[model samples]
Target: MSLHELRLLPWTTPEGNPCYLSADSDHSALSRLADDLEAAQLDSGAQVLAGARAVLADPGAGERAVRFALTRAVESLDDALRVAVSRGRRIPARHR
Candidate 1:
């Protein structure tokens, strides 16, 4: 497979660069780990959304609480977007 076909992992390196997997298929141990991590990231993002919504609906939420919720929501959104882009790129061109 070409470099274009490399699987974008669910995480980055220590320097915060994107990571990729070069296995022939997505069944390798490392690929499986990546899959698991992606699932966890998505799940965490959903939880963060719920919390953020609750915070937004709370009229008494202080600035600190709103800021904290906003920060977490931004982070979860970034993760979710990364996951989307990675999965989208992995799709076959013909399927597009």
Candidate 2:
């Protein structure tokens, strides 16, 4: 199936293992829920990036604060990666 027709949602199991679900159609209840969650996660990631930039600009920002921001950023990046992977699109090597 074409990537555009698929909806991918990244999630975690109760044990904290990363997981994902994919649906060919977006009208399903699960697909809608996944859409909502993905939107929220992307928004949150943007917010985190802003906050991290602010913290980085502050000379007084402690190591712990920077680490925390980095951690969140990494998690957000992973989520984005999962979303992209679920689309089943082959990213060009030059883009990497």
Candidate 3:
């Protein structure tokens, strides 16, 4: 089946392994939850980018402070990536 026909729900197993559920409808409870989580992650990434920019522009910002901001930004980026992968469609590459 085409990836667009499926909705991927992100979840974690008890052992912390990444897990996903594929459903036909986007209105399922798990799909709705995934959508909410994705929105939160995207918002967090945007906020972190703003904060990191501010920190970088401040001459008084110490190395530790910059590093901390970068770390958080990386985490936010990771979450955003997870959310994107969960909902994104895979396009087939054309033959050369």
Cα lDDT tens digits, model 2, 10-92, are 67779977664455555668867766777788888899899889889999999999999999999888877776675454344
- lDDT sort, best first: 1, 3, 2
Best TM-score among the predictions, by candidate number: 1
Q: What's the residue-level lDDT of 31 in candidate 3?
A: 74
Candidate 1 local lDDT, residue 61? 100
Clashes of 2: 0
Instruction: Residues 14-64, candidate 3: write the lDDT tens digits.
Output: 996776666665677887787788798789899999999999999999999
Error of 3 at 57 (Å): 0.4
The candidate with the higher lDDT, 1 or 2, is: 1
Clashing pairs in 1: none
Q: Which ten residues in a row have the lowest lDDT in candidate 1?
A: 1-10
Error (Å) of candidate 1 at residue 76 is 0.6
lDDT of 1 by residue, 1-96 (tens): 344478888899999999988878667899889889889999999999999999999999999999999999999998998899888988778898
TM-score of each model, paired residue for residue: 0.92, 0.72, 0.75
Model 3: lDDT of residue 59: 99
